[model samples]
Target: MGHIIDISHHQDPTKMNYDKLSAQLDLVIVRTQYGSRVIDKHYKTHHREFQKRGIPTAAYAWVRGISLNDMKVEAIDFYQRTKEFNPTFWFLDVEEESMKDMRAGVSAYVRALRNCGAKKVGIYVGHHLYKKFNLNLNEVDAIWIPHYGKNNGQVTSQPSFPCDIHQYTDKGRLEGYSGYLDLNRLMGTKPLEFFTGKEVVKVDKKDEIKKDKPSDWAKEAWEWAKKEGFLDGTRPKEPVTREELAVVLQRLVKKLG
Candidate 1:
């Protein structure tokens, strides 16, 4: 794919430059600072500079230690400030293992975000947290899965609760970024209007994905895709291999369409 990228302030300033990055990436997710005691502060320049860019952008918030009672307070403190960014998507970073009121906290954050006019409120969690929760994901609008398998393993393929994106690695180095940042793919959640109350527009190539994963299919389908050149085991970075993309698209056009 062309110009695929991710952004987070957690990188070393000595390593990454925002303006230089804006020149390359077509889409970037700028991490926002949390105005709370429990959250970590992100780079302010990252936020300012991403907004200045002409690219399609989204934002993420650190949603640690949130609760239902603090819905108003949390909503105001956490997400309200990000409204300045008319984000096409928003993500809640669920990297905690503390398990302190995790369910209520997650539900409240998701609900509050939905109520906040976000076109899509995304939940991001690593594979461990995901399996631990084993929570009925059908309730959540969409999922952002983070799996950095050196061998490049695919995550689960739930038919109903189809994931929206996959973070193939957390140790990615890119053009403008100075430190390791997430490298993700925009997976499918078609009829985006259902949850977002928006209209059906043409889907971007990254978004026109099928729910079929090699690990999710029958033994034959999986093999056929691979033999026919669909699911190649490769790590993701700023720019994906178009050759691989073409193979996946060819397979999906038949399997998905």
Candidate 2:
């Protein structure tokens, strides 16, 4: 299995060797923000550097909201900043006792993320508080529970509860880094694609053609535009920009002239 690790400003990018780290990592989940405020200083660099090396990446935000409204605000802030990166998943790192009703607060956070168009959402709960918090797990697409068996830089025992991903060690040592890194493992029968949302599917050629080709209603006009040298017959299913429309209009005007 490919190694997975999470990082924040704690793992200084300037000191860390990304060339070695990127070769070993299958996924990298970077912390986006610490709450509604205080965006992680190295988040953008971490995301870009890993992604540049062709490793899939995800984003997580430490949940520090005290009220339900605060939870929503934090979620919006997390999405707004990290959405441009198009992370495979957005995770809520709920570790501290922020609110009286954490269940409701966590649910609100998930809902707000969904409202802002976040498709794949997950939660990372401290293993000790797994049962104590009684978080609304149903709201998320995946659950991540941390169980550092001895925190001895090795995976000793698995998390007691069922989860999509497990953070087995915080003091884990890897070949690329000299310091401690949070190392994770994919649990149970779920494949890596389940978390990355990159599941491969077999498609029939006929169905592919039907999806890519122009619809019957637009076929005649589409052909006419192409034949008349006004429009290029490519990317028919893609959106048209103002610049492309202007060019098309110019071509049509010249043709008529």
Candidate 3:
């Protein structure tokens, strides 16, 4: 649905105009850090400039570690540094060096990130590397695949797996960019909320507020949901299971339709 691009220090930020690029691209993912301590030199600059130009941005941290504890350290460091930027999506760059134990390593990194309260965590890997490691792709919120064509950067063949974003070519040329740049394609349409948390909307508190009301702000939403048959017939105080929540969502979609 939209044109997306990924960049790091490898591409010179000094040469790229954030305003022009923002006009041309829908989204951007910048490299924030590597391992635990090494921050990308251009990360803060890119993040700030992109935001100034009103461009939506996300970030990825390169995963580095030999063990689970090492991965946890890297996750903590990553969360501390990039949490300030508040990327629309946070991804762990999983490449050959980080895939030592393969499945367990990936699991450890994802778990550490979740523990650190990172939202919308995703994985970035190549097709060959994914198949080689037999990665459990379900561990993250989204999958980013980098598969160039038969030759390097040609983009002749399609990736064999379902992916949310595909890095199709590394030989892309964009205005304001000095040389070739990495290009990505967003496969399906998703709102910015799919990556970022939804915006909080303020609602009025009227005389109809009840003693066991959810939240003063959520009361209106709850009443609408209940009236539309999106809720089970249970009382509002009852807890919802994962299964019940799913059914409610399905019904809400049909109601909206």
lDDT agreement of model 1 with the native? 0.60
Q: TM-score of the candidate numbered 1?
A: 0.60
Worst 10 residues of 1 by lDDT: 151-160
Best by TM-score: 2
Give per-residue lDDT, candidate 3, residue 93: 88
TM-score for candidate 3, residues paired by index: 0.71
Estimated TM-score for each candidate: 0.60, 0.77, 0.71
Off by over 4 Å in 2: 201-257
For candidate 3, the per-residue lDDT at 205 reads 65
* Candidate 3 deviant stretches above 4 angstroms: 150-155, 188-193, 196-257
lDDT (tens digit, per residue) of candidate 3 on 170-217: 887777777788887655565545754546465556523443456677
Better structure of 2 and 3 per lDDT:
2
Best by lDDT: 2
Clashes (N, CA, C under 3 Å) per candidate: 2, 0, 1
State in Å the error of residue 216, model 2: 35
Question: What lDDT does candidate 2 reach at residue 177?
Answer: 77
lDDT of 2 by residue, 1-257 (tens): 67899999999988788889888888999999998779999999999999998888999999999999999999999999999899999999999999999999999999999999999999999989999999989889889999987888777988889898989888977777788999999887878987666768988998867766898899999899889988888877778999999999999888788
